[model samples]
Target: MRAHKITLAALVVAAGLSLTACQNDGDDTAATTDPSSVATTSPSAGGAGSDGSDAASPEASSGGKDTTAGAGTGEQSTSGKCRTDGLKITAIDNFIDGDPQGTVAVEMKNTSGRDCVIAGFAGVDLKTNEGTLSAERKGEPGDPYVLKNGKTIAFSVTYPLNETGGTGVRITNLVVTPPNETKSVTLPWPGKPSLPVTDGSGEPVRVGPIGSAGQGG
Candidate 1:
């Protein structure tokens, strides 16, 4: 009977040892694996964070919005200075026999930004195939012919056929300078002098660049 009791005690000790070993193994495994290590990826797109905000739409690259102010419409008159389009030659007329003496009419329009004057118009002449070799203005010679922007002004410059041998040859190389501002433009004439319309007229025809119209060109 004592032998049986010894066997039971031995078995009980072995069972206790086994239970303790199982608990120790469980704690060691838990320490090695970190529970706080969560995935940083987004749930919806599974996308990762980038250096900038959300991806830009295609429109952001192409056809982007323009924030700059547009150029003035032809309707608005200019102020302070003049632009190239300000002074233009609207019409060129030939009166076969308007006056007893044949006369050629050249019309000019002031489309200045503000009150402006014409300094001079010269160079090309319709009468002479070549540009006008000499040009002369009588009234306000080198004086500013003033105009409130937008109104068309006609100046009658009669070239007497009698004085110079000219028929079917009108006027050319006409330039006008303004008194108030220095900015001047080459008024568009019947034919373009340069080889190509795109080419710039040789020397800076000195009416003035806008800001300098009154003071410079």
Candidate 2:
């Protein structure tokens, strides 16, 4: 009985020692593991921010520049072409002494307040008792003339004079059309009623291009 009691006490001490050794082995395994070695996810390049808003692009970051306004400052503004309503027309007798051709100077003054352009030949016609006779243009059309406010330009009409008082057309009025205009203005003939003869070209009247006031005839 005494021997059995001692053996039983020894068995209890060995079981307690084996349990302490197993607890120490578990503590060493937990201490050897590193926390930094755990896998984690990272944000992608140019991804959204933490607040869930998209990142700004290169164009949006820079302040937008205005490419339209005041871009045409280097260009000049040009005046419009002259119209008949803006002009005051008049006729003057421009015939010289002993000259075979009867010359009439038709003058136009720009009554409009703005500057205007007058280019090419003016259309001229002679109103007679028989009918309306249109004048033929002569020479090259010159450069455009700028007529300012209250400025004047003139053109001439030439025809063979009836010095012998032979059969001819009796003129009553002069009808004039400004350059680049479809409208017409009429003015009375400046002198006594006279007859005009047509030249070999069958052109009863000849009209010249627009020029300065005193350049006509």
Candidate 3:
């Protein structure tokens, strides 16, 4: 019986050693296979990737630059004096009734291709058959006149009627100069325009200030 007990005890010790070896192997496998040791990959910062989505994506790369920055806003803007080379000057004859005076409208039209601004009065004088009739400005100049292309502004010249013994002075030509202009334009007198008196005395023949076309005398 004792010999049988000794054999059983030896078998028990061998089984215990086998169990301990199994547990040690399990621990070694777990330590070697830690999650931190596993290699991981991420997208490249240089935009070098297989998907190409980092650079090729329209929405992601659209914030690079504005191609239309500092572009012009398609419209013309200007300010300065009106050029006389682009202006057309003429006279409008509307005879005044029942008086020794007559109304002559001196019209200025802007034939220029651009916009302009004109201010102050025009320099005017009458060329008479007898001699030149030096006249003076009548009223104060109006505000700054903004003249656009194909637009017209006007001023008036008043002189005496051509009645016998009434201003015997005969008008042959009308000379006009725009405000702030060195050049002058001469308009032919349609008919014989005369002043009430032969000698230049009182405001003989007066020229009014420049005004817009829509304004009346």
Q: For each candidate, what is the lDDT?
A: 0.42, 0.75, 0.72
lDDT of 3 by residue, 1-217 (tens): 9999999999999999999999999999988777435522233444354466654667645544453342442222243677778788888785745655677888888888877788777888788767776667788888777777888888887766656666566778999888899899998975445665645444467777778334422
Per-residue lDDT of candidate 1, residues 11-60 (tens digit)? 99999999999999999877665542333224323342232236544564
Question: Candidate 2 lDDT, tens digit per residue, 108-172?
Answer: 88888888888788888888887888888887788777778788888888876766566566888
Model 1 residue 138 lDDT score: 39
Report the lDDT of model 3 for residue 169. 69
Steric clashes per prediction = 32, 0, 3
Question: All predictions: root-mean-square deviation over Cα?
Answer: 16.3, 17.5, 15.2
TM-scores for all candidates: the values are 0.32, 0.61, 0.58
Q: Give candidate 2's error at residue 5 in angstroms.
A: 78
- Candidate with more favorable, higher TM-score: 2 or 3: 2
Pick out the ten consecutive residues of candidate 2 with the lowest summed lDDT.
36-45
Which structure among the candidates has the greatest lDDT? 2
Q: Please identify which of the two predictions, 1 or 3, would achieve the higher TM-score against the true structure.
A: 3
Model 1: residues with Cα > 4 Å off, grouped in runs: 1-83, 94-100, 118-127, 140-146, 162-217
